[model samples]
Target chain A: MINSISKVINDVGLHARPAAEFVKLASGFQASIKVRNLTSASAWVDAKSIISILMLGVSKDHEVELMADGLDEELAITTLRNLIESNFK
Target chain B: MHYTLVDLLKSEHIMMAVQAADAKAAIELLTAALVESGYAEPEFSVDVWKRELAFPTGLPTQPVAIAIPHADPDHVNNSAVCIGVLATPVEFGQMGTDGSIKLLVNIVFLLAIKEREKQVAMIQQLITLIQSPALLAGLISAKDKNQVLDLIQQTLNEEHK
Candidate 1:
């Protein structure tokens, strides 16, 4: 099953530390999580990879889509959205 | 395993007057250079560019603006560096703990080896180079490819010794 959540990056852009933190959180899930910019189709990336996420160039107020598929898709989506909402707090 | 930035850049990989009118274009040009150098496939550029859109790599410099072009190591086929100097500045995300950034003129592209263990030293060296203002300015003022390469070599030499 495919589950998804969307959130805007409010704490500025996803730089090194936050990207690292986001990857760490995503890596905990059994599902395959991917993140992308909602405004652009070309922004999709592996959510569990810090380098991949850092390459996305996401800026403040940029909306992103988090999609996951696997055994724990719902939990992955919820956790990812929460992270994005909290600006990776 | 360890190569100088100039050693990483081949003549075939060098593109002068890259038609980079914007950030996306700059990325495309840099990625294309990587492919032409045999460091990656043609599709690699688009794949990395897509990833870049989700996570920006603009680094805010103490003296000036700079950007680091990076992607998942798996997206690259070989290890190398590709650089593009925008004739006109473009906005990059930011660096380190803080995300504040403005217009940046220089971009240092990184195509890392697939395994992290294989690139530890190179990555450390590059990061150190990034944080050095003297080296950064020297690179920015470099007039040509040879000068740029020399600057990188000089910095690397200082770092190693």
Candidate 2:
């Protein structure tokens, strides 16, 4: 398993489009990925579920922790971390 | 911050047993409610339909499938919700899937959010409301607009906890 924490830098945080993009990317990987809003101290939710991510209610400058487990965990973690670091570009 | 789900839900915006041909028609039918009520601009229908074509909002919730459609905040004048309980199910592309994946949606919640930042919180509350099968059942079985309003109000009241 691999885990990392990153801050959301985008203007809208992980609200709609950004959250959709994140989930779309996460769904492509075979590993099971989970994310939690560290700033809000929220419970972990499936990273690939758009509804669950939106329910986190993450706002700008909020920190989120992500965990991935399975065969491709390392790649999944790195790719997702980069997506956040790049502000979901 | 002051607005809750109940605040956005108006009795006039709730429609039971709506008849529409497809997803596009369903969205347009509901978007009209928001525009007529001064919550959104006329362009909102076009924008929301485009967004629905892109991301799709259909959720495969048991007993009753639903779609929560929304557009960019720019087209909205007030943050509000428009509910459409379909008289017959319409096919909608399932959310988090390629456009090929579809679900027969029985209800639609057309959201018009005035601020981008508030989308997450409002959707969070919405998900909370939808996740409960009992509440969703109540919403679908609700006979009148006031009954629908009462159900949503009751659920949202428990949501703050």
Candidate 3:
């Protein structure tokens, strides 16, 4: 199990399109992935669910925690972190 | 006074059936309605269409599919969410995919947000309502604009309480 915290830099945060894109990528991995918005005080939610991601109420500069525990934990965390860093571009 | 989303929806006279050939038409039709109601400028529709081409708002929700077609704040005169229930679902590219993939969208939640910063918060509330199967059922089963508005108002207000 591994987890990391990072801020959402996208203009819209992890809402609609960006959240959907992140969920799509996270679902491709075999790891059990979850995300929590530290800024919003939201609980961890299934990373593969776009709607759940939106529930985090993440806005730009909102810090989020991503956790993964499975065979692809490392890969999942890396890719997910990079995706956020790239602003979902 | 802070206007709630429901208030904006009602004041703008948004929420209606849309008969369009595709997503582009649906967006145009909704934005045109807003313009006719004196909510948005005429150019807002065109800008929204372009933004749809760039970053699709199609959300592949369960039980029912929906989309949110919107543009930059510069194009809007007032912040309103114009609901357009497409008679026939149209194809819209998935967001953040740069148009590589598409989804069939039947409900268009065209957002006329005057402030870009507020868009995320509004979407969060909307997604919360949409995440519930029962609420989604309520939204999908609504018959007309008033019914849709009622369902939304009831649901959103319930969430607050």
Query: Of the candidates shown, which would achieve the greatest TM-score relative to the real structure?
Result: 2
Return the clash pairs for model 3, or none: none
- Give the CAPRI rating of model 2: incorrect
lDDT to native, each model: 0.65, 0.83, 0.76
Candidate 2 at residue A66, lDDT?
94
Please report the candidate that would top lDDT against the real structure.
2
Query: Which DockQ-derived CAPRI band holds candidate 1?
Result: incorrect
Task: Indicate the fraction of true inter-chain contacts that candidate 3 also forms.
Answer: 0.17
Cα miss at B34, model 1 (Å)? 1.5
Docking class of 3: incorrect
True contacts kept of 2: 0.21
Report, for all candidates in order, the number of backbone clashes.
13, 0, 0
Q: Ten-residue segment with the worst summed lDDT in candidate 1 chain A?
A: A37-46
Best by DockQ: 2
Q: Give one digit per residue, the lDDT tens place, for model 1 in B87-115.
A: 66776655322224445656545454454
Task: Give residue B139's error in model 3 in angstroms.
Answer: 2.8
User: On a 0 to 100 scale, what is the lDDT of residue A50 in model 2?
Assistant: 59
| TM-score per candidate, chains pooled | 0.61, 0.69, 0.64
Q: What is the lDDT of residue B99 in candidate 1?
A: 29
